[model samples]
Target chain A: MTVTSPEKAKIELRDVRKSFGAVNIIHGLDLSIEGGEFVVFVGPSGCGKSTLLRMIAGLEDVTSGDIFIAGRDVTELDPAKRGIAMVFQSYALYPHMSVRENLAFGLEMAKTPAEEIERQVQGAAQILKIGPLLERRPGQLSGGQRQRVAIGRAIVRKPLAFLFDEPLSNLDAELRVSMRIEIARLHRELGNTMIYVTHDQTEAMTLADRIVVLRDGRIEQVGTPREVYEDPSNLFVAGFIGSPRMNIVDAIYAGDGRIKIADTVMALGQNFAGVAAGDGIKLGIRPEHLNVAQSSSTALRAKVDFAEYLGSTRYLYCYLPSGETITVEQRDGRDLSSGEEIFLRCDPERLRLFSTGGDRLRSANTAGMPTA
Target chain B: MARTRNSSARRLFANIRYHGFGIVVGLLFLAPLVWSVLVSFKPSVEARQPPLPPWPVDGFSVQSYDNLAQYGSGIWTYTGNSLMVSAATVVASVIVSLFAGYGFSRFRFPFKNALFVLIISTVMIPFQSILTPLFLILTKLGLQNTLTGIVLVYVTLQLPFSIFMMRNAFDAVPKEIEDAARVDGASVLRVLYRIMLPLVLPGVVTVAIFAFLASWNEFLAALILLTDQNKYTLPVLMAAVRSGQFGTIDWGAVQSGVTLMMAPCLALFLLLQRYYIRGLTAGAVK
Candidate 1:
């Protein structure tokens, strides 16, 4: 962990903006990543997460604004002088270089002493468990091995921060999981600030101390995994952060703390003060939050459409009487068959309300709880 | 067991058909070189036969090669000139094209595509058509009868296609590799020379081979530009010997000269054929 110093490094982007020709890619954005924090930029493709990472690494120029790494302005500096290292999605190990040469190349370029370079290269190789593959060329290694060498190459640089651009994307599912774990372990052991970019929310959730959710080049929400998951700032974050996505359906706010879906009325329980009676609202619910009820009068009526069985848990796909589709996760082995009628129940506290424009609408009781 | 046997039999038949066609086409291409080698061993009178047979009926001898050595300034002079011109062309063209192609592939400037298209369009203008102007320019540069003139012209002619091929070769390298190298503390030139160039070496070999062959075997430019027989390349010298001014053509000398010309080309392909095919196919896919 004392590769450089255990001291953590911070990166700050001040009103950063990027543009290509007449098209703007990253809007004016401000963010501060604390020292040693594992911050993940998660978004769908074309959301400029990779662009932002490249800008921070100085591989891409900022259309406007400044970037500071460890309190030094690096916006106009070359990538080499910025003291950053990146692991590319392609694994970009020089095909002509052996694994040892690949790891030693940056140090050699910097005129590091031969013995010291050898020590650092061997140290990285051992850490990544690639000692046996040191002499082999990149083409001789598997996808996983190549990625390990790439990480080793980055590690030998002993940079202040590490930038990962979808590093696990080219790996197969099993290898991706293991490599993800390896990256998390590397972050913990190195205790260096790392900014990882990925479209996979699972990677973002498991790896990041804090996640930055982006939509159309703008920051949607930045918070801890639980904060983003349990309390999303907007509809986009709620739908994007979870597997299979959250079910969003239309509802009408009925008077006296009640919401109506079809002919069924549900109690708000907590007062959502700003909502007026008869105003249209969008309801968001996680599949695990919806329970299958036998015969409750307050339950929403639905007919089973299909079910996906996964040994321990099953997802039931259903259609409401009002023609909306709902997904419910069941673990109790409820023998719900296709085309059969069923009732679904949701806890009042688990319900999420959004105005028609997709902003999270907070109830008065939860207003002062926490904001993401 | 019967089905397995049947599929194996079908696969064997398919293999025969594929390789059978390939062998036939390969032999067709090899026939001329084989014939030239055979004729080079034949005595002068037998080599002049209307249809030169595969084997010399009059018995083999090294007489034609000896004849080539005895005539005019001799075959070694022409061989030396050809080697100098080809080597210079290969080195110059490959160096210019590697940097130019990398620039075209990685950097963006005003009218970049237009410039690339402009360079590529030079390939469409046949070398034969530009002979007169090239000769005039050589004379104006006072390089009219010099090996440097021939080398300069050869490098110019080889560049358009070489640059195009090298551009594709560089493009085949993922941009991420360059970015990774940049962040790894390599300067741009270091990235090109130490990283990118080595990876695209197959393409460089391909360009070198093409340039060497173009300059080595070139006839028209050398013929027009160099009026001095001593400075003539192998092909031009062979042409001069083939059309005997007052005497009958020295069939043995011409055959040996040709066999000599074919030697380097054959050896080059034998050595670098793998890279030749790889260079052509590398950038065709991802």
Candidate 2:
């Protein structure tokens, strides 16, 4: 979770803020994205992820702080002068132009020689595998092809960085997954610094070397996918990063390093000897960590509300007697069905303790650190 | 199979009835123009005969056309004046309104709403009310009876609707496209001219056609403006035909004059018909 890499001083945002007249969109945000790294800014819609990307691109003015690209202040530079290219969600390809012209437009605008522009356009088309579609207009191509042309347009610019805003959002599911892998592969091939913004966590997780989790215009966490998923610094990151979001249950600190949740009593592994009793807390558990084990000290009686069978795996949405719902991911073949009664168990080390205010409460595990 | 045949026959019959009614309406509207063309070929006396028995084709002659030409058809001069004024008005109106439209659609400067409302409001006011003041201003500028002066009036009269149409057209063009152009290193003017303009060509062409027809066919203002026959536009000259030069009417010349005036407007309409309708419908979708 603490792993870090070099090139960490590439892009620096020094207390950046964006405002439209009286209303501010981005509060003072300060995050340095490293060079040659694929960083994704993710949040729900209207969280200003796209706005922040545009601001960093110099398309939107940073109302307060300075933006530095490659250690040089570029707060007032134009987007092209800032050495960045962007892929818009709508593809933004010139509808009247052929794919070739779309890829060559920025270069043409910069007056790159006709021959050089042709070479770059062809090279980008070949890289995106849109070579055959070079003659086709945006209106003629499929959505996925148009998206590739958009990415090709950005690629032909060959800038220091690439900014993408929900580029795969308009594609079908099958194309989305392929494009996600293609983007990751592109990062591998190009090794150029890329900043992507999306509301979809899977895209953020798969494409990002480091993911910046945002909420309502402020960043909540900045970490790699593994760090955000398995060792979230707060409740927001934990709940936002994973599919079948981490199950958070209410608990009260019982006497002698134990916590009580509904009717079950669980040990906290002696890390909380300095804490008092009856402190209100929350327990965080990932669905896959909830197992059926006879050796566990605590158990909850749950009735299955429903079960989803996805061939090799099953997801049981179980309701405890206290009326709290929890999802259990089962990989083994089991006859788990709706309304079935079973006891759910989790290891003491696997349980995450949080304050009532949605902050993870860390304690030294006597057994060892919870290895994810 | 019989049911299918009956349904097919019913659809065919419905189509025929629909087209038949449309044809009747079209014929009724076109009756005058057709009669004008036929009258252009008839002798001065025969032109008065009702359009029946094919209008005595054997008796048809070009004497009227020759006489009208000899008696100073001035049709050529009128046509030249109309063409000059209309062409200038179309070009000037399209370019000026394009800038105004882009401003109203894209920018948020002060007084934008008030200015736009003022422009659109002028459309509702009758042109006759402003003609007097407008004429006075033109007289002071020494613009009356000249093509440039008349074109100024045409452009001024048409700019309001041009601004409204072009604004709607520009509004229909996605802001993202222009923003993309900006990020692609295009300045605002470059974005407007190169990217936004091409995408809204249908709307622009439609507006140009409207301006063309308006200036070419404008009668009242041209009558008030042009004093000399040399500066007479087609509409003003066509109106002159309604009152003959002599006490008696010159049916031959009047008929030919009416046809001459109608040709440019109709030809331009037919040429850009598709774009015209499409431009009108463009605002709805975008």
Candidate 3:
């Protein structure tokens, strides 16, 4: 087989839809992944991330649509003939075969020359650092070692692309992190288009060249990690992307570029033409964005309910008078006891507004909005 | 110190009692077999006497075996017939049940569960009740009085249990293994032969042993279906020896035949007992 050019390695999904009986698993979705790009699909369970990956791998059938790999329509092709390899969550190693046989299985099936199969197997073993484990069976190896054998099996195939289905989920935490770095390094060294599925947002943030956030079988946002984190397109993406999660407070829109939260009314430093005066809206702010205010009249008053100390920083879980809870990241080393009264402030420019229906309410000055 | 010593003594007594009961049960099962073996070694004339001093008091001899060898078209012919029929039955049953079990465990089609239940339901219908029908079917197929007929009937009889064991064995293997193989470019038949057969070997051994023993020891079918004297299995020959020639019972020949028939079954069970137990309990817990 000839090596695929970078241009020919692009994957395109056109209007893909999957349904089982009367229930729909994936709604119509269209995506194009560029050659040599590392894309991560992040979603909650049942959001069809893994299902979509399987469909692309040809392990699952497409109810309707076309899937293109290396510019060829392969929606109905066998998984092996589609020029892609997948590393499964369970490792899916043949328990009876040695690590060497496991790596050589696909090449043997393809009827490659005996010497070439040996060389490729050795190369994959060297790449995964599993050369010492070539004679051991999958049952005799640890979780991480089995995972390397699984990846080595995929690598020997020299596929046009690689699909990973939550491959690190079964390992211990420390091993997961190390394997994650190894996978990233592998992508860099090989420069192949790779699509990864995971529910770990930290992994998505750290590994993805581009992150596709999905919810309920629909794409919520597609962007770089920083873009999705700092400028989410909607409320779901905003709430789902961050670690300690962005805090949301119920607020009423007051006219003249202002919003009323709990009892304090503050200028938002932006004009919103999508909302009327006295209309209900949600105020979004990240934990790190909210700070302990130093005697400001415009600050919101809250009582600290708890503080979680993480050595370098603390998270203050506070409750407003209206019974709304919020978390504030404190890094100044000042300690505040539970039930202590405190004032919180956020930069006006950092505030985000959302309609009650969960869509972002863009400010008037942003593109595609009418100025007030 | 006194309490510890008393407890230690009590534990020792309990241990002896437990093992003593086990030994009693073991001997109860082995005693008849041991007696038959010893009686087969007695001289032809002394074997007819009372059971006192069960061993050959006149001196151990091959006279009973020689006597058994001379009865009814000779012993080797019947032994060969039994061996061929039993071996054919084992091979046929293993192949048929393995494919059937893989299908039932892995594939989905209309009436799959219902069909499996139907196959398994045949086990409840006693073999005696169906023997006449089977005989008639074999006659229609021109198989009566042939070793092939006996083998066919035995394989059919072994199907329900063999397939059940094999399906359980296949079900115990994870489906992801097959998926992985297919993704690795293995064809379906290759997957079954190269991967699945090794994993389900214990179940195959279990099926083969049951089929061999059942066909080897079966007497009624051989008697009812076969009309030729040369086609008699060992059990049928044993029955003839028990009836005796002209009102005189050949106790020596009968004891020798019994001993010979018991050897293969015991050896097979002992040799593959681990697989048999594992296959029996394969899906019982999971």
Candidate 4:
């Protein structure tokens, strides 16, 4: 009953695509996931992250290209033969089977010996702390216990990898937080390549070793949590990765060293490759980076519309002179009345510039900026 | 206080009306069974004099039940034949419809919906319209006068609704459960028999009960297909006994035959009514 090390099993997708009749779902995509990496696919609904994960799991047809799991061509392999186990959002435990039976089912199907099956089932139950619930049916258990039984069922297989399809979405907020930590701990202990799909950015930010941001069936960015948060690849990633999302506003390239936004000019210390004078662009600033400044020509003027106070920090919702909405994070506990005019400023290097097409334009002087 | 009293009075009136209507409808269905039982107890001479009253005028006796053996190879032969035909029909129909139902509910194939529609549409065609053709087909197949032929016809007749009920039962199970089973290394047939079938047990019981009742009470098909006197089911023998030679009808024998037919159906329904109701509402919401 030795558990196989998953550190040698890498998964790669080469030009994989999926379509339903004439409607394309997943566009041609190529990605290589290193062994033992915990990758999270994060996207809005209809972004095809679930479809992509299902394709990798062999539950869905690839429609076009090849997939390799542990250097084996698995495009034609059955799901059971693919050496992976999946924990579904609905838990999908056999309602008629006891937890012990559920955990032992896959091994039984493989014709494993009875002693080994018992050993593995008990081992999984102990790991999941479901030993007391082992003899109970799924309907008799609570939601969290049912999910634990589901994970136990997966782990008894000792699969090459684990696929989670929004496994925590059905739990309450408190349970979701606790279960998220449990899964991260499980990944650390198991050391298997895990591909998790969720639309919640917090799950992506907290649990992922690398988050693959998807939009409209295509990958928008792939980076570590800090990289995606501070140095996003596009406007979508910038707006998607943070809570109280990054503020985006229309701006114009005023000249060689400055940008103009609603008649207020700011100096830039870095050169952008394709930007020219009088070109329209978008400027993004994280809420925490923007702060109140004394009235000045260089600062943007805004009137506070509302404030949401969370114990340590408050979000000041405001509108700019151009009638665009912006949020500023205020941790100083100052009481600002709605409709009070305020000037806001930020370090020029903290700004994220995007082209009209929404792709991020990196600043050459990024090294000067302080790290979070 | 006045408003509360008004609402309570209205609720009391509604309860009375509800119970009253239920009592009337319940008795209306029970009346035929009561009449049959009463007639079975009365002497043949007094049974023939009935205006179909609720009770027998003469004192009750088992004379009619005693007289049941003189007609058509005895009551036991007819009962055995009926039991065999109905049991075979239930087994065949339940198995065929269980597979068909799971297939129709889960898998997609070319013209699957059209095929399902074609199968279900058979329920709408009157048996009389196909009687002549069915007779000729059974004759050509050399299945005439055999219990197999009648069982086949009963199963064919019961399949449309049986499949429909089974499909709904399987539909109530989420697709993810089946996917999990498959990923757990179950073959398609294993998934049906082991995982899916157990979940849909109520539907299976419902199908079995329906097939049982349909084959048990079916008269015309059995009368035509089962030309052999020994092969006649309960209803066919009952019909033969009721259509007494010339103009004489043995009311006692006829009523006893009916009570015999009613006994098994009643026993089955009483035992499995819970499953029947559960199956009917199985996929209605989920």
Better of 2 and 4 by lDDT: 4
List model 2 lDDT by residue over B114-229, tens digit each. 98999899889899998998889999999867889889999989999899999988888877777677778888888887899988888899889989989988999999888888
Q: List the TM-score for candidate 2's chain B.
A: 0.93
lDDT of 1 by residue, A79-146 (tens): 98888889999999999999999999999999999999999999998899999999999999999999
Candidates' C-alpha lDDT: 0.91, 0.83, 0.91, 0.89
Q: Scoring each candidate complex against the real one, what DockQ results? A: 0.84, 0.64, 0.61, 0.76
Most DockQ-accurate candidate: 1
**Which runs of model 2 end up more than 4 angstroms from their true locations?**
A1-9, A270-276, A292-297, A364-372, B51-58, B67-73
**Worst 10 contiguous positions by lDDT, candidate 3 chain B:** B174-183
Query: Which CAPRI tier for candidate 2?
Result: medium
TM values, all candidates: 0.95, 0.93, 0.91, 0.93
Candidate 4 collision pairs: none
CAPRI docking class of candidate 3: medium
C-alpha lDDT of residue B106 in model 2: 90
Please list all clashing residue pairs in model 3, or write none if there are none.
Answer: none
Off by over 4 Å in 1: A1-6, A365-370, B1-23, B49-54
lDDT of 4 at B111: 96
Pairs of residues clashing in candidate 1: none
Write the residue-wise lDDT of candidate 4 on B1-286 in tens digits.
9999999999999999999999999999998899888889888778778455646777887788888877769899999999999999999999999999999998878899999999999989999899888888889999878888888888999999999999999999998899888789988899898899889999999999999999999988887777789888999888888888689988888998888889999999999999888988897785
Each candidate's root-mean-square deviation in Å?
A: 2.5, 3.7, 3.2, 3.1
The candidate with the higher lDDT, 2 or 3, is: 3
The TM-score of candidate 4 is: 0.93
Model 4 — interface RMS deviation? 0.6
- Specify the poorest-scoring 10-residue window by lDDT in model 3 chain A: A363-372
